[model samples]
Target: MPLTKEQVIETLRQVNYPGYSRDIVSFGLIQKLDVSDEMIRVHLVVRSTDNNVAQTIKRDVEAKLKEAYPAAKHEVVSEIQEPPQFKTTASETAGKEKFLAGIKHKVAVASGKGGVGKSTVAVNLAVALVKLGKKVGLLDADIYGPSIPLMLGVDEKPLYDGKKIQTIEKYGVHLMSLGFLIDNSEAVIWRGALVHRALQQLMSDVAWPELDIILFDMPPGTGDAQLTLSQSVSLDGAVIVSTPQDVALIDAIKGVQMFRKVNVPIMGIIENMSYFVCPHCGERTDIFDHGGVAKVCAQLETELLGEVPIDARIREGGDGGKPIVAMDPESPQSKVFLEIAQKMYDKIENQ
Candidate 1:
């Protein structure tokens, strides 16, 4: 017996967003549906960037369809809607004049939640861009949990040249972070206003060299720090990082919406720790389950820049104050970072 559109729809109705009560079919995520003989094709439009949700929906839909008709063949087509465009205001233009004067592009590495390796992405991305022969600078704007210093192996305090503070140079990229100023044991317990002031100082007071790009390692969340940075500079765009999980995707969605609200162009999404490859046996494992970020990016109409699998060496490199891209440029992992960097550079250049 041939499959029917109603049967396919009913099958899809079994799949739901991880944290939501609504099913894919009921949410109007099914943009197009076709049924012919034993074959079925579905075009799905999802709004969340959670790769797991999308994969789950696709898997369930296909599985149920096959269960109903053993001879059924099916295909799922997904489309992500682009975020709404926001017009820049006069004040926004004025804000850009205060900092980042000579830099060609300023990009932010952000995430909805912490522990998604946002800083690691920023550090390696900056290093990758540098390897591509472009000058770059990295600013650790995560005042409370600044890890840029540890990741880049920078320990000395920034020097002052009377006119402005001098950034430390390492691996062909300039660096700045609150980690350089305060003692590692001490906590940044300042109020929101104080945090903003310090960030302002980092931008306006630093004697950053003329460079092709500056990447800000932003703190996680849609908080005051993010707002301050977005409102303080003319950010070229933002790259969101997330893992292939529902919790992380929920936050990633918030981060994307926040950037859109503030008028920062979203360059794309990157899935960090998308999967794990065992060293001894070379077996692949979806440690956190995969494809959530890709689905989210599709729904948001943003690019899925690339995916970085879970590797022990990546963690070891960061702890040793060396990013994989700089320490092992020829490694497969390093190539991933370089490729993502190239995509970003191309996007900025084309813009």
Candidate 2:
């Protein structure tokens, strides 16, 4: 059989970053790969000041490749990228505190994969927190595909008064997203470097008022955005969102593991699209199969915060920019979000 790039990647998965349980693949260290029947090669960009870390990774990757393909020629090349050097003056440090001073807690609502309604949960949760009379801010961190503006029905750009960007206010929550700044016809095709800089500005350059918490509706997967956020702010913790299925749960597990590897607390797991209930008949059905997240929680030993059913009303609210939590607080769907928000707050305070 001919050697393939996918096969090489799968083989490299056996190599883990030194002292961490996660492999270099999930960290996105592998920059390039070339594979054929006779030769297999991989290029890695290691973000470590220690040259030993890069050399160890190269050695481990080469060993894994050779072990997997004994007869194939293996070449492992790596570029050791030391962390950036930056000088923060006293005034610059004070400026950072000025913008971030008002915030109390920063939480990231993230998913391992997309299409799991992660943003929906974030948008509604922020409003639900407001319903409890807690000041809240929602920073849409999905720069490539910012959806908070559309979901929160925010069409106008925020006020930028020379110094800082004042976030938009909607549904009793402060909001900021790349979607709000760009035209609807525009598409953001930013690279990793640009995405990192944008996230830094969104978090520290914005003039956010005093609030109970700031929920970062993170982009799916562990990529540049996630890396920048982890490094930029002192994150209180992270909430992983997932559906009740193997495919989705598979990525969900990765999300949890990634945070754990980074030493970030797992606030809890939210089982979205957990089940469906017939509105007319009032009979419940396990549309996506039930308790899959609970099973993952048990395996990961993480809290199962709450379950959000597959409700068309939730979808409609998300599409219509009315977030069911604020649009219909009396509804059962809204109550679930309300309860989840409270649970998140409690954990935040105690931890």
Candidate 3:
């Protein structure tokens, strides 16, 4: 029997990338797969620059296919994408530099995995900074799942002047997000190259006002988008957000290592949903296993800036398109965000 595309995909699904739970096929690594007359041609793009990782993936694909079809001829074409370009002297790079000239600092709030409240942290941190009397801008770089527009209560589409995009403002923070550009039901099905281009435009083409700092709400994982942002603009530092669970902490380590490899300074880690405070009695419970983040931070020698308890008000505020800091600045949950923002600002100032 001749090999089918479905069969080939099923075989390739067994090939997992190093250090990640997702396989190559599901990770969007298998760009092209052609099978005809027992000959299989596979084209894949891996995000890592490591030659060993690429060779391993190639070997795994070929081995799996050969095992499935003894008479098959398999050809694996693999390419490693170069990291984002950072040089600013060249004419091509000069535009990117000029785009970021007005902002004094650029910080990325990132996580190695999803469901860590990374975007929530990014939004509140930006708002808290605004409360502290600094001119701030927030860019939602999580193209696949942008939530800043919803979180900040901005539902209207952004207006673009001929040359630059006009950002929507709410609660004293200038905001831009992919959510504002597309309808809620619309899905973003962009390739790595297109994603990189969209992110570049989000930073450079947006008519961002002069500000003390701009916070980038980055998408989860150490993939193309993360690399694109780190390379395209000069980042002052990055803040890693994670829950206190062992699984989240494990992935948070990867987030730290990724920033270090890109030469971006680690601002510190924020443990979100660290605990739950009973509304009736005010008793704090270790809902997700407490102190895991602190232990990881100690081992990594990075500061554990603060811990935000799991609060229903926080969730409600986010769902209502109003962050806690902006909705109720006097609340305990809001104060936590404010303190983290101040710590971050102080660290940047001292450095």
Candidate 4:
């Protein structure tokens, strides 16, 4: 039989910490504790500044879990969360005025690696926000793989006045992507300096007149492209996307780190393809095994925006050049996307 939550908590209590009376589970360090079909997954958070204790806790947790449940498939991830510290007014207010200019707020959509549907989320999110009567703009910063144009069905090239580049509007949202300018057959090969210049030009030169929210479809990975783009743009926050697989989470953490290093507040995480739903019987299957993002979010002490299940319609809509949110606004999946955008707006505008 599969282990219960009670059994998991009991086993954790047996694993002690150095010079501490409370156990790992009781200290409220364990989060997203889940068990299904003899498979176990959980995350343990420790202070990143204290390297010795963090390593010890990780090893102790892994060894204890294996001894208790030898036959079960287990995955335990450890994250180091540094408690928030107060900063002086000078540092905190360095770029606040410059960052919030004509745009009310700017959010970057990022992933640890490619092929996690980061661009798709960016495109549909901008559209969803527009549907809610918000003036939204989508900037595709994935220079190499600029998919925003194709995703938004914008084929015609953007018109340019002498001074600034005009934004192409589709589905009530201003959009700009490298895919619109560059030849599909050609490639964009540039180094960090050049790439940074290109992104800056896109942001400052584009006439994205009076946007309530601007979403940058950031390139995947924690490479020069991402670091440069984050530095050049006055970002209000970031939204991370990841799959439920462990490999995806590994990359997702790198993304979170990059944003944190740049001091961009992480709005939340969205777990795409969290699970697969059987349409016939309305049954849910843990295809990739869900809760990976939730576990990581709890470890990092960040909000979980929401989870998007793997559905045929999502893929079909992308392939058909029609976003699900624009095609079927009344569907449950569309509702979830709208809710995420709304929650983001509340976080930025209300605060």
Candidate 5:
């Protein structure tokens, strides 16, 4: 069988963009492909501050090709490049039907990698804002993993207020998510294009009432959701969340750089699970090792918005569908998120 460029490209499509469900081919990450009977060569251009991204892509490309052609020689070249500004400035959205148009402030709560409590912070922060008497809406843009509905304890589908779907209110905050629209048990098996379109509909298709601000619980990674938000909407800023560890901080730093690269102001970073305090004994333990966020903030020149300790109360509240901030605003467990929310809202307002 003769090796062909088409076959090589198709095989490469199986390689997903490092942290996302999408492929490199769809993202236009494959810069060049050369195929012949003697050898197969591929060039990939990854636009990420994380150097590991390029290596990961190159490794995946080689592995796929090698599996397909065991006897053929292969060369994978990866180019690490900085992407041009990928955001729509406030000026660009003027006179345009950009989503987030009427809101006083538009913000995205994001993390490059998941499992660092990004969505947790977003949920608590939104509740905190409402407690502070700010009209707020939360859009669960994590189409693939919509948790807003579960975390906020809203079960019913959003009722239409005429032509547009009305946001389901919970804990005094307006909330919308695909999780609310579909069966919670059913998985959202969507491609990148569908995910992109869904985000548009989530933002522009629905009727979000005029409010002080809205926070987008962005999906993890620099994929479709982030791409759609950065290119189409005018975001006031973004709040990055991470754990107090090297792996999480590395991804968190990449997230901060991505927002900065696209001209999105980083409101600050929230070190979630920053530390764990003993319930039995009054002792503090750095479960994931502390002080990493301070170093990250110093290196990135961003603010350490606040630290959220690892507490059972937070988890219990989230799982129980009554976040601590809204349930007990005066509790210490809730104050971390509240303080961060206050800082974010005040920062965006001052801007």
Candidate 6:
């Protein structure tokens, strides 16, 4: 009723690594193979930091083993074996240095809550950076609701240029979103591990042309998925987005704390929808109550980058697939984004 260790190893042996032609089990990377009635447990070692290939192998092996041995349940635990110091020769060292490649800086835009205009800020910030003559890339790592494609007005799928996936270009900014890979009508339902793999692909599988900056639109939360993300890449900094509401400010603090826990710098905080400007009277109102984020940032001894007023035009512009900053470069809302962009540049450049 239980699969023996040899059968487990042989089953894994049939699954091939995508980049490498070798089977996983024969590579001597399979360990702790155990079997019980109707259950299979195993551990796998993936040497090197090539997470993309390792994940692919893991997924394929799991799917195949479950299909071939339909009556049995299997669970595989995997770990990456760090490459030895001496094995990293001069040439290898040079190759690995190209991880971020041409990117001068990477900023992750995150929030503690959803529907707080986190993606909107991320999209506008990337556009703002491009407007300032910097080559930019906006990676929509928000695996669940990837609205970057919708915000940027690019409905076309990215071109696969032989070796790497080419990011779709729009508004002078290279764009990549999970939305580009799936049908617009479909939904992405993935657990934490799957989300991590997808994020890894977006970071490593794609060829982001020499970029001055790359903005990541991270998913909302402080869950394991977000924790795994913080551990994976070396972020230059993170900009937490929040509204003027007290609950939102609390979550924003948690976002800042998460980055601080992982040693990533908190570039600053951006207050979105801080206030509303009446279209009919041109009067400003603290719709959500103003200065909440700025006060919080001050208490934490961090910078409050800038405040984005709640303007109907900004919402309209986003829904219409043209970010407010791009649609009306001279508008008041646009000015706020521009100021935030300038301050962010100064902060990172000084570092």
Q: All candidates' TM-scores?
A: 0.79, 0.73, 0.74, 0.77, 0.75, 0.71
Off by over 4 Å in 6: 1-98
TM-score: model 2 vs. ground truth:
0.73
Kindly report which residue pairs in candidate 3 clash with one another: none
Off by over 4 Å in 2: 1-99
**lDDT (10s digit) by residue, model 2, range 49-166:** 4677789999999888878899989888999864333443566445445346679998999999999999999999999999998999999999979999889888887898999889
lDDT of each: 0.87, 0.86, 0.86, 0.80, 0.84, 0.80
Root mean square deviation (Cα) for candidate 2: 8.5
**Top model by TM-score, which number?**
1
- Indicate the residue-level lDDT of 208 in model 6: 84
Please give me the total number of clashing residue pairs in predicted model 1. 9
Off by over 4 Å in 5: 1-92, 95-97
Q: lDDT tens digits, residues 156-180, model 4?
A: 9999999988999988888888788
Cα lDDT tens digits for candidate 3, 1-351: 666899889888888765445688876889898888668999999765466677888888888888887787889988876445333456645544756688998999999999999888898999999999999999999998998888888888889888988999899999999888888888887868999999988988899999999999999989889989877887889999999876787688788888877778888999999999999998989988788777667656689999998998888888898899998999999999999999999999888
Model 2, global lDDT: 0.86
Candidate scoring better on TM-score of 1 and 6: 1
- What CA root-mean-square deviation does each model show from the true structure? 7.9, 8.5, 9.0, 9.7, 8.5, 16.5
Model 5, span 83-147: residue lDDT tens:
45665556767623467677777899999799998888889999999989999999999998999
